[model samples]
Target: MSRSWVEAERAMVRRTRLRISALVALAITVLVAFVGGIAYTAMVHAQDAQVKRELRYNAQFGSPSVPPGCTWLFVLADGVIDDGLIPVPPGFPLHGDLDAARVSGQTIEREIERNGTEYLVLSQPSGAGRTVQTVFDKRYQLADRRHLLLALAVAEICGLLAAAVTGMGVGRGTVAPLAEALARQRRFVTDASHELRTPIARAYTRAQLLARRAAAAGLPVDHRAGLDKLANSIRGLGDVVDDLLLSARLNEQSAGPDGQAVDLAALAEAAVETEGERAGERRITLTVDRPAGPLVVTGVETALRRAVDELLANAVRHTPEGGRIDVRLRRDARGYVELTVADTGGGFDPVEADRLFDRFHRRPAGPDRSFGLGLALLREVVTRHGGTVEAISHPGRGARFTLRLPAADPGVVAGAGAEEVSTGFR
Candidate 1:
């Protein structure tokens, strides 16, 4: 039981780690993207302001005949440069006449291209023989865009990192309480089982001794029967303790070390034999049918044995006197080996069939005499082996419990023949 808690804790830790990492990455990405976009927008606006200021200065100052400043070397009249004015640079468009600049009595402007750079142009009449022309370089605007994009990329990376860290914190915070609850529950089960086992064993032994003495003394046989009944009840309690301890150990070893290979077919046969020996008076017969040669599965032998034992025990306890119990181990269509325990007993509620594997669940329509742990324990065993357990039943018909296990690698282990009763790996 403690082992189960530990496994849960480990799983929680792993999940928390992953969740936190992802969240932190996501948060950081968003933060960086938002900050970088704002920064880029501001940079673009600043570049635009600078370009517009330069254009306004040229318009207020002069024409192509005179340079307003070093930055404004030429201004045009309409679309052409005035005569006797040299071209400021080879890429600059020739200045135009005042008449063209005054067309329609309104300014007509457009962006122009020069020397692989963008320039914003403004054309308006300054006065006679002059037209105001302004051109602002757009290279700085392009450079600002590049810088902004680079900043955004950097911000995105930083955001991702921050998100990862924050995610981890959140995951850990969320899982801590759950882990603690799991640990406490496991401890309770383990401690309770351990404490109950000693008293149950002692009670069973005392009752048996009393019954034997009563028979030897030839006292009232009916009184001895009562003692016998008490003994059986105590024995049943012991069985429950055994199941708890077995579950605890199996859960621990399942994660600590992988189970060794054992012949599942052999195990099934042995379990059948044991069941028959104990339940013969009930007229329960055990049979083994195996078409698949030796079938080896990876799991703790004791746990698997207990699981098989539970299935057979359930069949025997519920099967009517003279009823047949069939135990078969064979390969399924999916290539997995299946161990099935079928009994001609009072079948369970079809609706309750699904809940049989749940711990502490008893069918209201079926047997009133069950601890409800048998099928649950069986499920744990099958799960540890990376297998599955299922129950099929119908009212007034027989019931079947099927356990499916992954087929063992033939190269590593071979199937044991039916003749061999026991093959201990230990």
Candidate 2:
């Protein structure tokens, strides 16, 4: 499958998940706000109702009789502000709004704050010329309301955090099927590639046999040339298939017998020398710089060699004839062994840097030798080795590709192959 189509499928899955998660979170937030508002309002209204009930009871059954913790003021023949009835709390302000409300013969209640305390005052006209005023301390009620508000605020914050976490979980769950399908596709590629190996080997054998016959019989030069080309094509196809299978299977990695300590500096020197010969053929200058001491790592030597070879191969292919290629190995500040290949070639567009490692992503007018799977497989292999790789480039300037592997201590490398087993096939 093409890379774009696979990316589109993943994009669709992510979009669907985001929309579903967003809608769910929005619905939950709205529901929580509605429920909280209703509950808070109910509690406030119930407290007000309790105050009003107390005011009514005091006004009806009391003329000369007064409640224990409540004050009453009268405004009638019998309902005068009788000082003998009850002693008023000090510094209480009597506003003109009270007289206007009594003249309109409407019951009015208002909260008053005095001396850092809250009080509820209710003024009501019981009958003609009978206005009764009562006051109740609301210090405890207001404090309870403040505590409830604080609790509600805390609940809201916690709920939002939980909703965000749940949304992430839901998104993953929703996209599980799409992820599984991609996995199945990779597995199919691996299986098909594995199945085609024997047939390819047989074809290669047949082509070699034909070439040998043409050379001995001297039938025609085209016979030899065409058969050689056929053999080369078959071999290339087999290589491509092998690469595909390896890329698919790299996720399931294990430390095998060949996963012994490797001298990184030595490996790099060998790759440079091998590629130096090829670079000479292209008239490109190849250079290598390394530390005097050995830089070691715990990994498969063949895999690391392939990685360096691929980078150098890319450099040679991209660089113009007589252009320069520099391969360097050094220890980074983080104690990682870094291998860098820089070439004076036509570099790629910077905007596409992020997609350089994606499978089947061929640059426009790229080299014919590339199947667009080299960097992708390189990424998988390096990541499995606990390393990282990146390409740095700018158009019309040049390109530099870097591979960094964590350096291994000499002691660790020495202890690696305590039990030497069979050296397996690559």
Candidate 3:
């Protein structure tokens, strides 16, 4: 896919996550506000109703008059206090909004402060243009409301925080697939670059030969060698491309119908046979040590063959002329099989040994070195076969490269229930 298209999709996912989080937060805020408003109004309503009922009962019954924590003041039409009532509570206000209540003979409730105490005052017209005011202390009710408001505020904050955390998780989850795709794209590019270096080198070498020939002789040059080199380079490039595509396909197939079981020992022997000519060209001594039992593994035969070829080729390249190269295959007690390639070459620094499997990584001291893709390709194939590759070397000491794979079970058709293992570089 195009980079722009991928970016647009990711942007849309991010926006969706943000919108979902915002909607959740908004819903919670609205719910809390609605519930809190109802609770506050109900609390105030109950307090007012209670005060009103007490006032009306005392006025009608005239028995034991005012209730505890409540006070009353009756203002007659001539502005005189009623002498028939009991004494009012200390710090309670005598004057309320009498004029306002008497204007329409309706109850006027207001919060009043007198002598440093708060009260809920209800003023209403009693009769004959007189006003009766009822006062109820509100210290405890106001405190309760404050605590309720604090609790609601805390709840609102917690709800917002939870929404934010959930939004972050949603965003990461949404982007995970895109991130994996981008990673695969980058890996393809790296692998392709590493593979292309070979053809480019071949082409450059052929061009140099043509240049030297033209410089030596006059005008018309022989196109045969040049054409042959060009063809070989193109063929090599095509082979690398095929190998890369096959590697990708193998990696992509997680639990599909993988190929049948192949004998690993036979594969290693075939690799040794194939690489024998190449080692002979450099006068290198190559040997293979096989275990008595047949070492079988479940994987693609072509891929496994390529893996062995790459390993042997690597050992031949690193080993000096007439050096010894040993290929050994062994099965351990833990039902794991290992293939080791130990060569008596001028070894590299052990610290940098692990980087040998990385694409295009080359040792500076190596002579006539090609772009480093052989080891990397080998690692990829082995990893797909549920195997791991390891590089063991030290400066001045020969390098030992090993491939460890899960051994196939002896029973039940001898090959099943195997999974690819994640591996590190050789």
Candidate 4:
């Protein structure tokens, strides 16, 4: 579950990074386009100014009663337009059609023919009548705008690539720690289970030998009591082993394995009955509240049953002899199936409830108590089956554990609830 949560977080971060990068790229493209447009406009304006200067110089000097060293021609008119080109001196350098000559209050634009070359005429204001000027077409400025646009396009591409690379790198780095933590946690459970199996087996064998020897001697020994203790110890070891293996298997299954419908209600009742028999004359009452049909779930049946059995065993072990115990299976408001186990023993330490499911955590140690693995195993079983367990306790009010699981077929209606009233005895 934690692993899935971390992956979800990484996905969100990746999406956010992509969106921000896109926005940045768009902003850069717009800014570059705007700057390029301004630069192109400036270039055209400067070129036009130079063309006007040349026209004015020619108007003041050297051409057909014009000033010396001024080579271009200028034509100014007020009303009617002229289609013919203005005559120019011998040395002008451009060629184009001269269209018209015009001078308004502050502007003069005219067509000028220079050395038999035709060009468009432009006019700017002078002392009295507007000064005439000629402007060539803006082919050079247009070429510059095209080149600027190409460069900006390349830069935007590079920026997007850089952003994507950086976001992925950072996201991977952030999730590395979470992965390491999960690996260590799984390994700890597996190694602990394997290590405890040896001592538990040895205790069971020794207890069996003692019982056999006592029975042969006909000493009226408490062989059953010794055997029960050994059995409980062995069962505790099995619980731990089951939890560890189940955790590992679920890890694999959730990754890719397929699951089928499992009837949890039936599974729970069978487990409770079996565990109740094991309790033998201990004052523990077994109550099962189940619907008529299957409370099916999409999961491995074995894993789910083991989890329920662990919870039952935990309640049995913790509750004092003759204390009431109740087990209920019902659906919650969200249509989730819940298996609840409640015990009316002297309640547990409220503060310790938080670590109830932790491995090797036992409560209020006593001489006859077994190893502290039952709750931990229960937690593993539920987790593997995609379920949740929560414990609520107080000083005197007994402990309650609720295991919530999603229903396999939401279309199935839940049956009526069941209540049990019975004496707590083995």
- Candidate 3: tens digits of C-alpha lDDT, residues 1-426: 335445655666678778878988998899999999999899888876876676665543332244455455555466665624677657543454766776777877777676556776667677776776666666776788788899999999998988887777877876657666765685676577567756665665666566566656654544554444444444444444544544444324352215556678987986686678779899999999998867877766556766777878878888889899999999877777889999998777888777988998886655565877888877777777778999898556588889887876665225332433211100
lDDT of 1 by residue, 157-184 (tens): 7677666666666656766767777677
Which 10-residue window in model 1 sums to the lowest lDDT? 417-426
Find the 10 residues in a row with the least total lDDT in model 3: 417-426
| Per-candidate count of clashing residue pairs (backbone under 3 Å) | 20, 3, 0, 26
In candidate 4, stretches whose alpha carbon ends up further than 4 angstroms from where it belongs are: 1-74, 78-192, 195-226, 249-325, 330-337, 342-401, 404-426
Best by TM-score: 1
Give stretches of model 3 more than 4 Å off: 1-259, 364-369, 411-426
* Candidates' C-alpha lDDT: 0.70, 0.73, 0.69, 0.60
The digit string of per-residue lDDT tens for model 2 on 97-205 reads 3465568988787878885787777777777566666677777778878888787778777777776766677667767676768767986997898898778878888
User: What's the residue-level lDDT of 399 in candidate 3?
Assistant: 85
Cα TM-score per model: 0.57, 0.54, 0.48, 0.48
Candidate number with the higher TM-score (1 or 3): 1
Candidate 3: pairs in clash = none
The lDDT ranking, best first, is: 2, 1, 3, 4
Model 3 vs truth, CA RMSD: 14.3
Query: Against the correct fold, how does model 2 do in TM-score?
Result: 0.54
Candidates 3 and 4 compared by lDDT, better number: 3
Model 1 CA lDDT for position 254? 46
Write candidate 4's Cα lDDT for 80-170 as tens digits. 2222255444433222222222223444455455534545444443344433443443445456657767876777678667667655665
